[model samples]
Target: MELQQLFLEAIQNGTMEGFFKLISYFQTQSEPAYCGLASLSMVLNALSIDPGRKWKGPWRWFDESMLDCCEPLEKVKAKGISFGKVVCLAQCAGAKVEAFRSNLSTIDDFRKHVMACTASDDCHLISSYHRGLFKQTGSGHFSPIGGYHAEKDMALILDVARFKYPPHWVPLPLLWEAMNTIDEATGLHRGFVLVSKLHRAPALLYTLSCKHESWVSISKHLMDDLPVLLSSENVKDIKDVLSTLLSNLPPNFAEFIKWVAEVRRQEENGQKLSEEEKGRLAIKVRYLKKFSKLKGKKKA
Candidate 1:
C-alpha cells in the first residue's frame, strides 16, 4: 500500500529525462546481453565516440575496440562482463568514468545520487542489477536509468536487452535491492557507473588504426557462415560442427571462424553438405542471428 502511494505521488511530481532520451538513443545489444558493452556503447554513442562508423552486428571479437577491452576470449558469447572492463572501455572511448559497486548505504542516498547525475547534460549513467526484478527470471544485466519519478520514486530502467524486457519503471527501493549483490567473477556488488564527456586520446586512436583491419577480416569470415549457422536445429549441433571444422584450420585463424567461412562458401555456392556438415553450418548462422540488429549501429 505504501509503495502504491509512492507510485501515485511520483507520477504527479517526478520528471523522467532519461526516458525521453531513450526515444532518440536506446540501441539494443549487438549480441545477447553484453549489457555492459551495449549500455556503455549507448553512453559512448551519446558522447559521439564512433560518430558515423558503421558497426555490423557481429560479435565484439569482430570489433577492435570492444574485443580489446574485454578480457575472457569467450566473453564474446558468454557472460561475466566485469566492472573493470566497463571502466576500461569507457576510458578508451575518451570518457572519464567512475564505477560504484555495492556502495549505496541508503535508499535516499542512491536516489539522490541518481537524481543529481541525470540533472547533468555533460555525462550519462549506466547501472547493473541482479535478476531479482523483471519477474525474477534473468541474471545480471545493465541499462541506463532514463527517468526518476520523485513522488513515486520509480526509476526507469531503459533495458538495452530489448528482446528480453522493455523500458519500465522499477521502484527505486526494489532497483536498489537488485543492485546489492555480488558478481561471482569479481566478488564486487553490482551497482551503477557514470561516464563523462568524450575527448579522444591519441593512443586510443592509434590502437584502432592498428587493429582495424584484423577485425574487418574477422567479420567477413563470420558473415559468410552466419546465415547457415542461424538456421541450425539446436545449440549442440552448432557447437559440435564448429569444433570439427576448427581442428583442420591453420593455427593463426580462430577455429570457429574457419568453420563459419566454410559454411558460408558451401551455402552461397549452393553446394550440398553432409548431414554432419550441415549441422556445423547451422552453428555459424545461429550466432550470426545474434548480431544482425547492430549492423548499422556505430555503438554496440
Candidate 2:
C-alpha cells in the first residue's frame, strides 16, 4: 500500500493514532545497513525517552550514532544488526522491550501483538522481516508498524529505507511469513520488538556497584552468609556478626564508608533527600558504626 492508500484508510477508520506520534520522529537510515538503528531511534523518540546526552548543538536526542552500547557502530554499518542486538540496544537506551521471533511465536500471537501496539500511542512495534518474501528489492529490513487496518487485515510498515520504498501496507500473515524466514548471517529467524518506556526508581544517594569485580563475592555474602549469621541462635552478640562480616569485606569496602560520609555531608548542607535515600544512608551509617566498634575492640 502506498501513502495515498494509507491516508485513505486512516481517514476512513481513524486508526492512525500510533502513526501520528511516529511520523514526527520518523527518520531515514543514514547507512545502507542502519535500518535497525534508525527504526529504534524513531521509536525511542516517539516514546519520549531522554538520550541523557547531547545530540548536536545542545539537543539531547536519539540517533543512529547514539546507539552503540550493544555493538560498535562500525560493525553495524558493515553488517546490519541482528534481532538480539536490537533488543540489547533498546535495553541499554533504558527502554522496556519485549522481542518475539516468528519461528518461536505463532502468527496468531503476532497478530494479537500487532493489534495491541497499533491500537495505542503508549507503545510501538518494530518489525524485522525479509524483503524478498514481500517481493521487495532487499533481503532483510527493519521498520516500525505505523497502523493495523483490521478490516483489510493489512499492516502499515513505516519503512526506514525510504529511498528504496515508500510506506506501504502488507497483509499481516504475509509479514509474518517474511519474518519467519531464517537470516543467513545468524541462522535465526527475524522478529518484531515491542518498545515502551521503562519507569525508573527515584534517585538514590547511595547505591551498590554491580559492575565491580568483587561484586560477585560481596553479593554472595549478602545473600547467603548474612542470612545464616542473622538467624543462628548460637550467635549471641550482634558484634560478633559485625566482626565476621567486616573481616570478610572486600578491600574496596571503603567505598561504602565514603558514601556514608558523603550522605552525612549532604544532610549537613540542608539538601533534601528522599525517604529511600535516607533509609539507605541510615543502614550504611549503622554498619560503619558497628565496624568501628569492632576495630576499637581488636586494637585495645
Candidate 3:
C-alpha cells in the first residue's frame, strides 16, 4: 500500500491495521536498510495509538525530527565511525555478535535504541491517569510534548486486558501498589488507581526527558512503574502548577481542576508521603532552569 493511502486510511479507519500492513511490507523488502526499517517501525508504533480523526493536530511529532533526535542509527556516524558500514551490517541476515556489538560504541546510540522500543503497546502498560490540567499557550500548536496518544494507548491496553486477563490478575492491591509507585514518581499515582485497574505505566517517559529534572534518572525509570502525566484541561488556580513547566502556561486556567481535585482528595485521605516521598519526591521534578541554572538562586 502507498504511504499516502495508508495515512488517509489510518485517519478514516481509526485502526492501525493499515499502518502495520505497510510496516510489514517494508520489513519484508529485500535489502531493507536499518534507516528505512527503523523509520517505518517508529511510524507504525506511533500511528497505532489512533489519535482520532479530529485530533490530527500534531501528528507530525512522529516524523523525522523524532527519529533524528532519538534513533541510534542516526548517531552512528557522529562518533567518527562509518554509518554506511553499520547500516550494511544491520541489513545482513547474519546475527553476528561482533557486528551488533560494534553498534553499541556510543552511550547515546545505545540509549537511543533502547528508547525506540521501550514503553510500547506490546510489552508495557500505557499511562491513562489524567491530571486534567491543560495548558493553553495561546500558540497555534499545543505544548511541544502534548498529544492524545497517551489516552489512546491506555484505552487500547484496557480493551485488551479486560478480555485477556483473568480476574485474579486484575486485583486492586497489585494495581494499587503500581499506582502508588507512579504517584510518588509522578504525583499522579492517585489518578492511575482511579483510571485503570489492569496496569499503571506512564505514556510519555524518556521522550520528554528533555523537560525532566534529571535526564539520567528519568531515563532510568523509563521502563519502571512510574507514570508520566500531561493534561489538556485549563489551569485555573495556583494548585494547578506543574512540578515542571515546559514553558510559561497561558492565561487559561480551567484545565487544572482535575489535578486540584486529586490533590484535595489526597489531602482529605491523609495520604501524606513517608520517608520515600521525603527523599525521592524532590528528585522527580524537572527543575526550572532559571532557578537551577542561575548562580546563587535557592532551590525552593
Overall lDDT per candidate, in order of appearance:
0.62, 0.81, 0.26
lDDT of 2: 0.81
Higher-scoring candidate on TM-score, 1 or 3? 1
Q: Report RMSD (Å) for each prediction in the order shown.
A: 17.1, 6.8, 22.6
How are the candidates ranked when ordered by TM-score, highest leading?
A: 2, 1, 3
> By the TM-score metric, which is better: model 2 or model 3?
2
Worst 10 residues of 2 by lDDT: 203-212
**Model 1: ten consecutive residues of lowest lDDT:** 202-211
User: How many pairs in model 2 have backbone atoms within 3 A of each other, for residues 3 or more apart or on separate chains, i.e. clashes?
Assistant: 0
Query: What is the C-alpha lDDT profile of model 3 across 1-300, one tens digit per residue?
Result: 443443344345343332232233222211112223332223333334221111235341222222222335444323211222322322221111121222223334322322222322221112221122212111110000001122222111121111222111112222222222222322222211000012224222111213122443434443341223224545555555443242332222112221232233233453466675434433433332233343223222
Candidate 1 global lDDT: 0.62
Instruction: Write model 2 residue lDDT over 161-190, tens digit each, in one string.
Output: 999888888999899989998989999989
Against the true structure, what is each candidate's TM-score?
0.57, 0.70, 0.21
Instruction: Show model 2 residue runs off by greater than 4 Å.
Output: 1-6, 11-14, 203-300
Residue 110 local lDDT, model 2: 88
